[model samples]
Target: MSTGQTRSDRKPAPVKMVTTDTGRILRISPEDESARAAVAAAATPAPQNIDPARRTDVLFRVRRAEGHELSSWWMVGAFVVTSGLVIALLSWVPYSA
Candidate 1:
């Protein structure tokens, strides 16, 4: 007895709604793949600049640790011993500079 298409029998269309600050409702029903792709691409995040204060703080921390001197005699001794071993290793190699 029913002559019209029922809601259960019909395929639903894509509904996208965006609201503006001026009380405007934008209802967009994109009909093509290119329009959907354009919307998707536009929504992607672009790169932003580093905060100057944060960057300066990081740079300051790096430079703050730089000028502090360490009297590391033990480390120097270990390095000299390692260098001697490397020199000895190089002596075993034929025609090495």
Candidate 2:
């Protein structure tokens, strides 16, 4: 530690480490604008080292789910049905005149 050093002069921990249920080590970092890009770049596995099914993007799981052919239709239908049901039930409720 040097007395002349300002806060910015010190780089924060590269990444905070975590242990998964499967006993694999993971490095998680706060992903603000600057840190997100930097962490993504740093965490990208080498071509030979990566699993083909895994992705490093922020919404990897969502992106994968988004690939379904009927996902959008299902989402829209669910919203319409739920809202319609709620509104219909409320409309039928007896209100004090």
Every model's TM-score: 0.27, 0.35
What C-alpha lDDT values do all the predictions have? 0.64, 0.62
Off by over 4 Å in 1: 1-71
TM-score of 1: 0.27
lDDT of 1 at 19: 48
lDDT of 1 at 20: 36
What tens-digit string does per-residue lDDT give for candidate 1 at 1-97? 9989666966678878764333347566766556656655666443366443355335543322456755589789999999999999999999997
Candidate with top TM-score is 2
lDDT of 2 by residue, 2-79 (tens): 899567767785676755333357667665447545655666345665444564543443324555645588899999
